[model samples]
Target: MEPHAPAGRLAARAHLLAAAGRPEEGLPLLAAASGTTPAQHWAGVPWVADPTLGPRIEPGLLARTVMRLCTAVGDPAPATTVTSLRPYLTVVRHAVDAHGEHAMLLGAGSALARRLGEVRLAVEWAGRGARAQPSKLGEIWLGYAYRSAGRMPEALAALRRAVAYDPDDLSVYADVAATLADLGRLDEALRWTELALERDPDFDCVVHTAHRLRHRADGDVEHLVALADFVRDHPDDAHEHTDLEECCRNAAWLGGLPSGTPLPAGRAPVNAQPSADALHRLQRVSGPAWPHPPGAYDRALGLVLVEPWELLALLAHPETARAEQQDGLEVWACLGLLHHGTDEPWLDSSRRRLLLGLLDGEVDRVTQAALFAMVAYAWVDPEAREDVAAVVAARLTETASGANARAVAELALAAPGLDRPTRELAAATIRVPAAPRQRGRGRSLLRWRRD
Candidate 1:
């Protein structure tokens, strides 16, 4: 039902007045109007009291409410306001749920809670949303929330969904690709990432994914050399350094070393700028900080693939001189240990020590936990892959659990010497036997024989 006409007019004027910089006058009018209803004089105005309110409800309002609450006086009733907008929420929730069975609904709802700084609530809603909608976007958000909230199976399911739904949403391919890397789904992630780049060759997303694809275990070395050549000749474009570093890291991870080419290392890429080679989108989504530094994050990607030399080269470059570089360095060290046998000597040794030394220092808790995971992974003996897997399994149980953590645990079980408990844990993580692993002629490099 529509709100009363007079109330509608007042709400619209209040919204306009607020937008036009006359909130003082507009607020009183809204307050006067709201005073006559069951709703209190929020903003001294009748919110959504307009006749068009039903058709006008959108996620943007949730974002607006979040911004407003952040700037408002003592304790904005965000939860109440959101709940009161039920009619609109119902419409959106129903539509999204109907499309894919409630999977993506959590994403929309979680986004609403996330914007309002309700992180825990955001995670819960995102889980629900993904379970409801089952779309790529839904899975992406669900995985993101699961990772953030410490739920691995849910996170993996979401990420797997994202990969499965690709070529449909190019914008999300980068995230799905990255998640695949973290999960050690290398060949598959590379295939889809390449597809995304093919679809949008000049788009920054493609550039980013291409840089990563060249470092897959089965990556094309010739392309890596060519990309390196591209950077060598295009020295004037300092931004490409990030991409160059990525190429180098990917090569190193895939068992190739970066050419000791002596181009002067450039300055590190800034998080605020839209540089060509950042690993993650630097724009703040709904939190106080972006997930990780793009370059550092890229380095983390390299680590998972066993590329310590590239990480070392990047760390030594002047661009990586900042404190933020430490995060990538730490991950690189950890991944190096896990990818190559830890018994391999002189690889990321110093970086590992540096990270360990900083354990008691001023790093953030989340960062610290991540570092610990890397350290634990590194401590695993390659010959005793099962032993390493056991460590991850124990860590997963001890920790609240997240996507990466769960993935690590699963990888441990798949390790050569996995015991019963670890195997059981891994089994529990997968809700169903994965779809028959698909293979093409080139996919032979990924068969069980290789494993």
Candidate 2:
């Protein structure tokens, strides 16, 4: 009984530190404690009795806390640690049985799995819980896991169940609508989005959904301009920034065609098409600024950064024509290259040039891994292949975080440094849940394709 005392004290301190807005300082201590701690005990679950001690925290609390710390720490090892912990189902089972009041613990597990990029595992745990007991919380989680895994129909079904259980849960409805739109079921998606907005007009997610739908349905330039205006006014909301970015991307994709107007750039010119070299050049232009990119300089100063994926899309946009346009363009190009997956020639002539550009600048481990993954995917051309492989090998040996860590693991498998089983497991980590009928076509867009 007393054995839990020391750990409890440390855990409390960690929690206090995190709560006090000192997450950066609190994270390492949490990680050390997490690594030293054994799997949590589910049996002999005790309720709060000690007046001085307060309520007893669940054994699995460490795992969940460790994950939150990892997010705060912004390191790759924490994600790898969570992935490594996946084999032990008993740990999760114990937590579920012991912490009846802490359903959030189960939600945390599902979220952690998703964060580790283990979409299938995320769905599996969340789905099982939903099946076992159809609580509103469980249903909402099941829907999210399904959405992340690219199973749109299943996600909608789960969301419907969740809404039926509690129609007031605007968050669940917004998520469901988003997934529906991703699957191209725009009409249905719009309806659900409307339902959510009707319930809570100021809901952030609902606002985002309406913004996205307007672009898709009406391609309203005025609406996009308004959204951009709103984002500038509400700079603190990160999601708003994402919405504005998407609006910009949509505008570029529309390529000046009027709203509700037909596609104008329907055909590529004989030589004007996006050549392999042109694509590569466009991607490379994004950058390796010493002070980091213009808008992201402050965020970069903080601990372990995973280069934002949205930056790449911005680079790919035609409207990104400023001198600093390279900041967004290159990142967007990288994302497209990533979309090519690890087994194709998507990188080809264009990708190599872009990678070279990135190398020439001050790219970090995460960006390097992203470039390496693209090279691995475009595994053709002996000279380029060697260059990319060298980059990957070097990068893998050093530190990594976020998607880069996963990319590094994949590189090891492709190059022969990592063992077969570990490599397969890593690949499995990103494998999404079984695709539902509606989302089958969009599967490639959602998951992190190989290489």
Candidate 3:
């Protein structure tokens, strides 16, 4: 075989640095070797010059590789490795044009671009995916990409198209509700949340959506009370940890925090100007989450005063925070507030990586509690539940304290496909409330809509 190209050599060195615990130093190198621009990466490639380039990549091989790469990246991806893989994949993207799962590939590309805060690239991939063929995943991702790009009306239309594709998929309803809430249409959003709940009350997406919307609209302790009601109804379930802990944390702050604060008017997604990097997309999904230098109302919901990552970092390193910043009551209450209620991309990679790293290392009680409360929230997509469940269960065995242990145990039990031993341990440790009998489905849609 020929010796590696200089670009390949540069990429290899970057990966070596990351593997050696010098990830910060490696990031720039990896980004550089990838050429830092689509034009540079795709330049002179036969596939790019002509869609008719001969000898297309074997469809099955390309699809499987792309999917495996997706799973490997996970939340809080191995930063340098992911950065390197991205442009390399883009160069070969058109090579798999004939693949049956080409649409999925494009959707995955859109996701990577979105994570990097490249709004136009994200939307472009989604559009290509949707144009490649009409697919449920394609449409859902396109809707999501549009939402990220601040094209609210188009996002809604695409998401509704997804609903039209499969009304039985409860999560889609929750997505619709979330987008409505983004537009400050709480009533319509709530109706959609209820629509999902009536179909299946246990749905996690709707549950998170309901909590977020209720908290934003009511702007009171009542949202916390509502979460308490759910926790009481299903005590051992880990799915409630984020919501439950948030409620408890907020209840602690109700006395000190001010109320009746005026809120900024909502902006029209349509009127937003385009930028080269699309960093505005980041500001939209969850506003300037770290530092939150503007304080309070700067957050999307205005309920929590501190960024989730900042709270975790402060809790993890109280020695670094000032006396006043240490407790961060409002921060604790609002940790994961913005992202927990939504699906992927909104949660973002940096936050996911930080939370996961904290879970493995030592931290104070407050941080540990925060970690247990929000980990599952980051891993919100039901499709990835198995991986998230494994992560929670492994953490459960290592932790044997009371508060954090119970939270971890309950979270582990709540996950689907958990092993028997993990379930037994979680159940044996505490007395969770008996699950209420499930309500009958097939309720009147007309009544729900009219109400």
Candidate 4:
């Protein structure tokens, strides 16, 4: 590549640095390129010139470069960096109009808009791209943008259009299934999830969704069987540890295993250790906030929070668990909140301490009780249960100003295995009624019994 060739020096340097595992060093060059006019940036590139002169640029090179820079910056490029890409988006738009609707430019613009927290702009650009090209890729972006914006109906429609355009895209199938599941159409979601698995059974997200969908759709135990089978058959697969751990959790919840029972054979042991890299990846993905739209962020957060327990469960050695506890507590507390009505037998004293700390933080009292209730029902120790219940009851009283808070408190109290005193305290706060039993068809039976 010539020193002065279009994107030559910059792209070459960036590629070399990236190949050397020093991609961060190339950011300055990318940043400089971002500031240049699009035409100037492409000036010496062979493709932008008349073909007779030299080799042309590859079809998607420019767009790919921008995407590469964005990715290199981080999973989510800094908001400031994303904001800085606006000029480039303008250039892409100009190129689209000048070149009679280039799909790449439109798509890139859509992505840029989304990254910059401009969902409406993303929708507009993606829609234009789909209209221009009528391709599955364009439609996929349109659907994704719509979903990110919380426009679920439009998102579903666009995703369906993408499916019509290309039934073979397993990612689209997974997205469609997830969207349907979010809308409470679990049966339809299960069908799409199965289709996704049929296309690519090895994809972790697809498999995860299929299992979740099956559980939701009909309380089927098939997903557990499939997970066990996968673990037995593919022990060396990269995802084996996580998958097996999840299988154990589902087994406990769905199969009614008692607390502390050994998982079935071929399952990873509760003490199975996770690598440092895996833990780091989890924290990065599930950290305090996401760059996505709020609804999407909440959904992603809920999934991430609920998932780490299996991994946490596997780190059973007390010292190891303690060392990792701080890094994982946020996830656990969030999980407690999400699993409000569900029992999690994994909560121990250390984990409970982590949760108790959250109460002293900025979180609302009622939300804190709800989270505590999740942990409370899981406590096997009497003292721990009392402590958790006391916290819940106190928070319930403190938040007595809202019916919502009281309702949440009642739900927490309804969790099985509370002591009588805690139950009485809850009863004092809310109307606790007797458990009703159905009467037999017994007017004649009562008369006969009397006789």
Q: lDDT, candidate 2, residue 199?
A: 77
Provide the lDDT at 290 for model 3.
27
Q: Which ten residues in a row have the lowest lDDT in candidate 2?
A: 262-271
Error (Å) of candidate 2 at residue 254 is 11
lDDT value, candidate 4, whole model: 0.49
Which digits, one per residue and each the tens of the lDDT, describe model 4 over residues 1-451? Answer: 2334445466567556646755444433543454332223422322222222111222255456555444434423455565445444544444555553667656766776676677888888788888888988888788878887889888899999998988876767877897898788888888988777777888666776676667556533334445544544554654323332433342322211112322111111243454555454444433222211111123334433433344333222223334534332333334433333224443444344434543432223223332533432333233344555556655555644443343434534433344556555555555643233222221111010101
Model 2 spans with C-alpha error above 4 angstroms:
1-103, 235-241, 247-451
273-320: candidate 2 lDDT, tens digit per residue: 233444444544344321111122122222112222232333223343
Candidate 1: global Cα-lDDT?
Answer: 0.42
TM-score per candidate:
0.31, 0.42, 0.42, 0.42
Q: Output the worst ten-in-a-row residue range by lDDT, candidate 4.
A: 442-451
RMSD of 3: 21.3
Clashes of each: 18, 11, 1, 3
When 1 and 2 are scored with lDDT, the better candidate is 2
How much is the lDDT of residue 273 in candidate 4?
Answer: 54
lDDT score, candidate 1, position 21: 56
